[model samples]
Target: MDPDRPLIPAELNRYARPDVLIEKGRLRFLELNISTRLGGDAVARWLADAYIGLCPESGLRRPPSTVAARCEALNRMRHAGNGHGGTGRLLIPIHSVIDVSGARQRRDRIQPVIVAGAQRLGFEVFQADLADLSLDAAGRLLVSDVPLDVVLLRWYGSDRIIDDGGGLAALCAADRAGTVGLFPRPESALVSSKAVLSWLREDCDAGVLGPADRALVRDHIPWTVCLGLDGDPEVERNLLRMAAAERDQLVAKPAVGQSSNEVIFGNQMSAQYWQSAVADAARESPLVLQRRVESGRITMPFRDRESGQRVTTRVPFVLSLFMVDRAAAGVLARHMTPDLPDGDVVIGMRHGARPNAVLLAPAS
Candidate 1:
């Protein structure tokens, strides 16, 4: 993908799944993960199976299957606007370089789960590194001489594509010529920035959002401001003032980041450190200062790994809603046990959080 190329109009409208935290009985969106390289689909399936086995008589509805929903999403994308009606070959390109953070190892573990699920649905699938993909003379994406209809991106970061000598150019050429489709679209890289969320809140504050849009923003989106040398002067001034008086209620996040890496919680910092950190981040690149939403706590049972004894404890949890083709597909819940040393400020796999099933209760 060319960094200077303007995105097509259709690319601007694509949506991604939202990672949400429940606070005060409302869903507060932490980030819009606009890429298809999302985690937890396989974990969701495993958790659902374990949950159903443990609560056979509970009468709660089984959670929708993320694997099935994602496979269906791929089928739809393969056929959408391409005029190819039959089953199409899908490829999951692995990155050539693996970072020390273990992201590649995690993706490698889950790729087979998705491939198996897609195979059961009668679609042909292939997995290979980005270097394995090449464009044929006709500009079609191919691996081992087999043409591919869609590329399911499971790798992290678009910068990897740019780092490849010719892979980025080939993919862009194939995508532009309509010989292949890229799920989630490359424009997702642009939309996934945390700055976009700040922009949404800023637009609402500026009265640019319509009545319904304003209500939606007010209800779900947290108060966020992009902090940088080029940022809105009024917004930056107000954010700094609030940070001074109520640092405990704020968090600073990189405008483009994954996991909890480099996330700074205001409450955990001294007043001097907080001020210096904010100033340093603004000088380097645009970062977002958002009102932090604390995760809701729930009591759930867990079996002790060493003793095999079931124990119940309170834990902090976050709910992630998966949206496929603009429709709600399923929900995934991740929680951290009370014993973790990180306390409740951050919760993720890196922080010892575990995936839990979300079972829907029967309506009265």
Candidate 2:
């Protein structure tokens, strides 16, 4: 993709799944995952259902299902494009060779739920390894002899698409030739990168954004800067100095990572270790350093395994909000308990955080 060319405004409207932490009674966005590969929706639906079943008098409604919303979004995109009319086939291309950390295992567990949801939505859904895709005479993507109308990318690392050779070529050709609709177009991953936050901050500083956009950045986005020295040297030097001096107020994250993998809290690291980590991360890949917002704690009920009784405990939690086609879909909340060994400043399922159902209160 051309760095100079701006993304089409329509493509930017696909999805915005932002992970947020509540600090001082305000929601602060930690990072944005703009692709269709957002997981935990199935689990969230299950939890919401179970909660409603156990407490029918709560007077709260279950949050909308992300899977159902995603299926509907895909169907709309297909119809808007050149999709085959009745019961078009949707193929979820899995990457067998490249796995992003524990993505393959999570995808394996989540795929069945997604497929079941898609099937219920009236689409003949199928999953296949990327290597299994083929192109017909019209550049249409096919799995075995069946042509596809839509492709859902379940894989995490978009950069690895180039490594798949023919599968990548055929898929790209099909998408570009309008033979098949690709949800959350591949370029959507670029908008998801943590580096984009840095760019937004830069744009705001340069007065490139309008008043409303600038206010949105100032109100929601934390102070963020890319770790590497790819841009202005003086700005890079100032960032380096600030990182070294304000270690307690910052966090370092990989620009294109998920599940809080390799996220380092500056307060948790010694000055020497923090410097070394920043240097190492800068050398490896694009990294972002952002001002840390301490996550607020909430009291929730949980069963005590050893005592065989229910108890309430305070835990740090993050709320993930999903917006499809610029409309609010639902929210999924995950909290980390103090007793968990893997509990840290970062909250994610991979780090032992447990999903909590978020229900909407009845209107007054």
Candidate 3:
């Protein structure tokens, strides 16, 4: 049943909340979604507007539209003047064929936020992508050839596309040794799955992603069978131990998947699905089953379309909350469409309404 206003905004909306910071000043809005990023130079022109607005010295040779052109424009603008950073600025790009597509636009959810945010914070703004990002037509390698200061790993909930950031973290050691700042942390990545509950078993956690979800991880053995042999016996024991110490019958997630790729009831997953190939199966790739996730019942509180009463039932749309560096960034309640299964509601993250970073609640 569809509600007039999505629960995303209703339960916990950053914009509607009271904690966001607002300096009395002028503000502008720009989007950088999948389609817009593919729009070639037009997107670049949009970025130029931001750069020029920030720094006037950035002389305009011509409005650029391509990646290289936009990079050039931004360079001229930021570096030409005194430049904002003590360290020289850098630019990087990631090419991906599996970027956001269809009715959902990437920009609508977020913009060139990293660059813009960093530039504002006095750090030299830079961009980079894997050598080959199937998402962009320029499918060529972005920063494979260049040395990088940061390995910006992308972590969306799923991995439907080639460049959806499935194996990005493993590469962090090889490429960037200094700082591998993921968009969200490892905590955010694993929380979506039953693994979260297991993780907290030794640590002590709370929420909907509670002990049940924990039991699915380590310290729990009778619950799991040895399917495809776990490499290290210790690793296996640790996993089972973690599971036993935690909760059970929870949603197992692809370590790196998005929206609703392999979203299934925990009972459906096989042992093979749990190991090395979790991302593959979760993303509908060629990989076989990993490990099983615990599954029982899922009931959510939803408002009936006709009756004003809030009913507890199950529907595809699940409540999701996002954070920027651990700060409550935004919230969205999405309808389950085919691809996304959980298509998002109005997606927005206002600065003022965000929660305090100091006050954090573990995944529930």
Candidate 4:
């Protein structure tokens, strides 16, 4: 590690996945996934397994595939005990509240796939919402009466987990007693906020980084300023003024947000709307005004669900790079239209920009 680099919280070391974009021979990092509740671990493993099974030859080139690597990491954690007995029983904590019907569907389809993988690796797996779990007076965490060894968090965010007094208190008690293990170690959420990224951006300009580190931050992170919180009020005020004047060159993002919620793009809206959004964003919640990077548009073929034929369409794509313990793990390529920045995957499965499995070609 470079001494000049910004000090990443010790908690983020457990899992440091960064969302990055590779364009024009430059790698731009958007944000870090420090929270353990992050999704897509299951998806990444599933995709890798499916791809390797479909084309065994590719596996020969990319040795010790992503899934294999992840399993090794999990097994290591299980064996470490980390104050708990290495019983090899892992619990995946989900959101306590959800539409019962949708939750059932996820239990039936989404979770079983990941459970199967865990079981194959010599581990007992249990899935339950956080509410279903209990920490007894003895500080033993249990799910349906079974003692848990480690927690593979699947909940989306930490705010809910931390706010659930019973759950939060139990987890903290167990953590202090060293009775159970949490993959992300809980403190990772502190750095997960976009506000931390803004601070990092400031560090770049302050010459806190070495020459090479400075170049990386300058080339990757967008110029960002945290608003509605700590920082030079004058600087933030100037940034807001500039955003209003040059509406097409900037975007305002929530400092603590997820899944593209309340992301206001200046280029796509009217001046009045953009200005209004900036004001509301700054006032409602801490926000970061980021210089917008135009996405790269490319054409790719997909098998149309209805037509049952391959169709080629042009869309803006983002390369989502996954990292585990600071090591590269997987890459997911997602594409969307200019109008829909984050893609429309949730509204309609086939309608939104979707990710495709990476296929490797034979070496020349």
Best-matching candidate per lDDT: 2
- Give TM-scores for every candidate, taking all chains together and pairing residue i with residue i: 0.86, 0.87, 0.33, 0.77
- For model 4, which pairs clash? 344-352
Residues 1-364, candidate 4: write the lDDT tens digits: 1123344465466565566655566676767655332334455456656877877866423222444445556778888886557888887765443432234223222345456667889889876666667776667787788878877754434333322436655655666666777765545555667887788888998999899988878888877778888667788778778888988878787887666667777878899988888878788879988777765557766677777787777676666655666676656666664344453122212547555555445667
User: Which model scores highest in TM-score?
Assistant: 2
Scored against the true structure, residue 138 in model 4 reaches a CA lDDT of: 69
Question: Stretches of candidate 3 above 4 Å error?
Answer: 1-92, 97-110, 128-151, 155-193, 202-257, 265-317, 336-364
In order, what lDDT does every prediction score?
0.74, 0.77, 0.32, 0.64
- How well is each residue in 302-364 modelled by candidate 2, as lDDT tens digits? 888788788888899999888777777788888986578533467888887887778898898
Candidate 1 total steric clashes = 0
TM-score of 1: 0.86
- Candidate 3 residue-wise lDDT at 108: 24
Which residue pairs come into collision in candidate 2? none
| Better lDDT candidate (1, 4) | 1
Candidate 3's residue-wise lDDT over 239-285, tens digit each?
44443333224333333333334433333345444332433343353
Query: Candidate 1 at 120: error in angstroms?
Result: 4.2
Q: Indicate the worst ten consecutive residues by lDDT in candidate 4.
A: 100-109
